[model samples]
Target: MPFYLEIIISVSLLTGGVFLLVGSYGLVRLPDIYMRLHSPTKASTLGITGVLIASMFFQSHLKGFLSIQELLITLFLFITAPVAANMIAKTALHHSNKPAEKTQNQALMDTIRDRESPPSNSIK
Candidate 1:
């Protein structure tokens, strides 16, 4: 392998390792459900992406043809991370004790319910 390519791969691996470490730390240390989402969803994403890029580069250099397994896996990870995160967040939201009233989303439902119901205080 060329010296420059080795350097690039080394840097990529180093950066990816750092990102993975940070992401794991954040997972352990971050507060709250939403805040914790930032760590795994964002850092892990970039970290794993770097690893995938590194793998692809290293594989291609060694094999003389593009190796797409890592690329496809990376694509799948990118596409699925958000969904998995969303599911997690949704589950947390569903189970959490956080006040539903604070969201103001209930206001929309309130209005809809009022529209559908006969007003009790409408000065009948």
Candidate 2:
């Protein structure tokens, strides 16, 4: 492998590692489920994306062709992370999960939950 390729891979891996570490730390240190969800869904998504990009680069360099597997993994990650986060947020709202004292827009969550719930008359 060329020196430039090595440097690229190293930088990508380091960036991924940093994001992963930040996500992990945030998950552990954040006060509530809503805030904690933000960390892994966003930061860890980017972190894994970075690692996948590095893998794609390395594999392409070695085999002289792009790696479809890495592309698929990245695509799925992009698709699923936010969807999963949204689902989790909805679940929390369904359970009336409380946000931390400092969390903003507390009423917005209640509004959303109300909007998503069918009217009582509809149940008849």
Q: Which candidate number has the best TM-score?
A: 2
- What does the lDDT come to for candidate 1? 0.80
Error of 1 at 44 (Å): 0.7
- TM-scores for all candidates: the values are 0.76, 0.88
lDDT of 1 by residue, 5-62 (tens): 9999999999988999999999888656656787888899989988989999999999
Clashing pairs in 1: none
For all the candidates, what are their Cα RMSDs to the real structure?
Answer: 8.1, 3.2
For model 2, the local distance difference test gives 0.91
Looking at model 1, residue 109 earns an lDDT score of: 40
**Candidate 1 off by > 4 Å:** 97-124
* Candidate 1, position 104, lDDT: 39
Candidate 1 C-alpha RMSD relative to the actual structure? 8.1
